[model samples]
Target: MPAGELFTVPPVRGGTKPEGSSRNKQKEYQLVRVKNTWCRVECRQEMPTTWEEDQVIVSQAKIGEQVTESGVSWVVKAPIYFCYKVIETQNLLNPSNKTLLYGHVSDPEEIDEYQKKTQKRFVVMDATVEQIYGSKVRKYFEAHNVVYKILALETTEETKSMDIVLHILEEVHKFSLDRRTEPIIAIGGGVCLDAVGLAASLYRRRTPYIRVPTTLLSYVDASVGAKNGVNFCNCKNKLGSYTPPIATFLDRSFIQTIPRRHISNGLGEILKMALMKHKGLFQILEKHGKYLLDSKFQSTNVLDCNDDAALKTTRLAIQTMLEELAPNLWEDDLDRLVDYGHVISPELEMNLLPALMHGEAVNIDMAFMTYVSHEIGLITLEERNRIVQCMQNLELPVFHRDCSFQLIKKALAERFKHSGGKLRLSLSTGLGTAEIFNNVSEETMMCAFAAWQEDLGEHST
Candidate 1:
């Protein structure tokens, strides 16, 4: 029999046909005449079979079997490609889907240009004090004729309330939507980005937004991915959403006016990325350690001191880390990648009454985590010492003594609850490999804390 010929008898819809001498499964076989030749063939069960006497039977292999010369054999696994074609049989079918824009911007001037190109409503959330960048941002928007709203966030610890930030975002979003805008835009550091990004997620039930990260921390770590949110009940970043921005713009010009402390803070985040994931970054930092340390202050002379080389190295390192970890950002497998040093740092920041900067706390937390890793035999003592030495070379504190042991224990216990009873922290196994654990004993934590306290005491006294 040949293919595509009419048959005298119509194929049964749900009835069985015989296969040689055995009873065939119902709807498993079809009999047809091809070019006036009659033959029985297996139905393509993977596809919907239509009944027609004029239609010819196509040879399709049976389930769990492959077609062969002698007989059907068990099927071996092979990749299959599926192409779908939607049939517009219904009158109400719609084909147009919503457009989502994702990316980042780094300059204040480029915000208007991006808005014009992407047709997204723009908003700039500034984490710095209003007296510094607020007027400048407003003037930039005005000169470019870009419609935007500037939310000048307060920098005090009391103003860092997650609820307050959320309220501000909600009000801004409502204002934007009262005029029928499509998307939201955020421009600032990690705190501003997280707060605004959360607002964008909640407003209109997940409106798209773009990020223009001005600070180095956001540029290297926070602003690149979709994780956005704010601290809850004094716990750092406790309430939030994993909402990826539509786009990100990396502009180095923003770093020009950044304060020295801000620069060092951002460096702390970069160091965390290097220590936890990329050994090449560690090498780069080691090579240019002095240059980075000297480039802390904002001066034309300081900027010319081979600082561009260090910035380029850090940028490349962060780009590589993002490319390697992009797929896992929204998934559940965040065990090692969560090694941003925020696990313990967040607790300290809350308990120490908020004078400690986020990255400073992270700096101390990374040191403690490294110490714990060494004690647990995950990493050698030398490696742990090297980690502390690197941080010290950068002029970052490896330990802090602002809180007492009782205060530390209380903070960790609270953190344990806030993290959903799982105290799994990202601990280093070596320079690049990090492990997450929920089973770190309280005794181990206290011992490590005590050691760190003693070390600090020796240095201070």
Candidate 2:
């Protein structure tokens, strides 16, 4: 019988129709057809049968079995897609799904409109935000009559353990938050984002969350990705999940109070994106990077303003990041351009913390990779110099003592396993273009490091 044809069962040798056959020791068979109120099935093997004159039988293979004659079988599956938006706003408290608001979020009235819109209660998780923003968050929530609680976290590398996560989950259970609507609002740098995001994901299987990245590193890279992670067992981000937040808000106002070096720290991730994909953004950085590094935009304090060159440059960098990440948010595809410096930077960053920032470690990784690309003839000497110079010009580090060849070779071995036994290393083929490499040799890496050291004298790691 053709597929999709309906059928019924016939009576047994005892002249009794099969009743509740589902519970009996029955063979799997595809149904064929029915006549009147009775059912019939074409048997593939001899068995007890009682047939009525009105019943009809048809031939078909058993269910869940494939015929060998034609030697063909197929099943179709639909692909899953995930998508979200990233926007810039002057003052997030003014009521927006995600906003980049300027000035301190001190005024309670600014967030009044948002309280009215959301019916669900919220829990604010802070790492360093309160120290930076003070009682503004508490006062705003209180004035708006928003049901909320505050949880303070250290958000340091040492504190990124399960204990911190469980502590936050305690609050989640106590608040009885509606997983579908109310979200945990994470405010701080990448550490806070990762810890809070992990807590939110574990509750009720998955809880919606909001991200307000307070540091520049979180703004350009960490918060934008769907990845949330915490260090564990002396490993960087060993425990984590790929859960995207409902939205991320970028506000330069928060970036203003931080030290100037932090801006350079964020530049490492920005430079990674520009190098791998957007040469135009790279050029923008080459020209206006110093202006941004100086916090000129925030110093001017232009709220509800546009047409700033620095702001445009930041937006371009963000747009470039989103363009690369939106298509592969969950990283189902392992071959990603964004994985350029990230291949080794995680281990490099965690091991050298206090001495090195996340972005700075990435810059050091990219610097060596740039030389590796050069040694392989993938990029010219001039191109290699330009890349290094661009990083140095932004006050980003090009080398660290811990980024030794021995350490790198060990990390590469582990990364090779993690990348399915292939290198999957991102290399520069040209300005704004990147290619993957699977056959980089240790000797070539040594030569790359030696060349980097020779070019950068006292800066050698």
- Top-lDDT structure, candidate number: 2
| Residue 7's lDDT in candidate 1 | 23
lDDT (CA) for every model shown? 0.61, 0.72
What would the TM-scores of all predictions be? 0.67, 0.77
lDDT of 1 at 417: 75
Which stretches of candidate 2 lie above 4 Å from their native place? 1-83, 94-120, 296-307, 457-461
Reference-based TM-score, model 2: 0.77
State in Å the error of residue 50, model 2.
33
Q: Give stretches of model 1 more than 4 Å off.
A: 1-120, 127-145, 155-157, 166-174, 177-182, 296-308, 320-325, 403-423, 437-443, 458-461
User: Which lDDT tens digits does candidate 1 get at residues 136-157?
Assistant: 5565545445456656665344
Error of 1 at 333 (Å): 2.4
Give Cα distance to truth, residue 420, candidate 1, Å.
7.1
